[model samples]
Target: MIRKMELKDREAFVAMANEFYHSDAVLHSIPESNIEKTFDELMAGSPYIDGYIFECDGEKAGYSLLSITYSNEAGGLVVWVEEIYILPKFQGRGIGKEYMDFVEEAYKDKAARIRLEVEEENERAIKIYEKKGYRQLDYLQMYKGK
Candidate 1:
């Protein structure tokens, strides 16, 4: 089952977030405090971010976080999916695809597009995204550290 994230699911979500990014050294360890803050922010109605949690067999299994942006160029709401993960133990069982399909159907009338980024080397994720109809963007993603 996929549902909007709630305050009670913070710990599980944080655990998944930390575990999903474990191999990447750049992401900070998500502290309990940070998770609490995130939960509060989401409940407080932040226009910028929203998250969804996936439950399997009555347990929290994974989640996706999205940030919304409006572009005059695009002329509608664009949803940038910053994070999507299903625990390693729970992977390969169609949960990810189910969650994505749910998101697409749920937001079909609201969002213009759902966008996500995967590292060039992450072939597994790339394949899944491509299978879901996401293609490579023509523009390069340039960023600077603060």
Candidate 2:
């Protein structure tokens, strides 16, 4: 099931975030020293950011973090999927598709667009995205390097 993360989920969230971030397939890993502090500062139950926890039979199975933004171009709210991770054992159970379906329905009326980025090398993820009808956009994502 899909539900907004609650305070009680903090420890679980942190652990999952850490595990997902450090996986060899994950190209974007936060500094080892700042994980907790960074999560606290930016994701401490902020309204602008929605962290969704996925559960199966009451067990924490995965999570997806989404951020809302005001896009003048869209002239409305836009949603971005910051990160999505399903635990190792739970992989290939259609959980990711279910999560995307939940996200699509949740934002159907409120968001002008929903966006996510995937690494070129993550072929499994790419297939899921393509099957879900997501198309590659022309614009590239850029960030100011440290």
Candidate 3:
């Protein structure tokens, strides 16, 4: 099952997030401070962000973070799937596809597009995403962060 993240989920969420950032799934590790800040932002009821915790047999299995933004090119609201991480033990059980389905169903009416970024080297994830009908965007993504 997947549900909105709550304050009580902090410990598990942090552990999983830290693992995710440090694993091959990501390009680099982020400071733990950033993880804490993300939790705080999610808990603060921010309108632009949403967090969900995935459960398997009543155990915390993983988490996903999503961000919302308006895109003129997309002609409406865009739902950016910022992060998705499943515990190592639960990795092959089709949960990722379930999460994708959930996101699609949840935003079908409100969003013009559902977007996400995947590391080019992460071939496994790329296959799953491609099977789910996600296509690569040709433009290079760049950001200037403070």
Best by TM-score: 3
Residues 37-94, model 3: lDDT tens digits: 9999999999899999999978999999999999999999999999999999998999
Q: How far in Å is the alpha carbon of 36 misplaced in model 2? A: 2.8
| CA lDDT of each prediction against the hidden true structure | 0.78, 0.83, 0.95
- Candidate scoring better on TM-score of 1 and 2: 2
Can you tell me which runs of candidate 2 are displaced by over 4 Å? 32-34, 37-44
lDDT of 1 by residue, 10-102 (tens): 778878777766655224455666666766788788998898998888878888888889867667888888888887777888987787788
Per-residue C-alpha lDDT of model 2 across residues 126-146, encoded as one tens digit per residue:
898899899999996688965
For candidate 2, give the lDDT of residue 45: 60
For candidate 2, the lDDT comes to: 0.83
Backbone collisions counted per model: 0, 0, 0
TM-score of candidate 2 versus the correct structure, residues matched by position: 0.88
Q: Positional deviation of 64 in candidate 1, in angstroms?
A: 1.1
What lDDT does candidate 3 reach at residue 135? 96
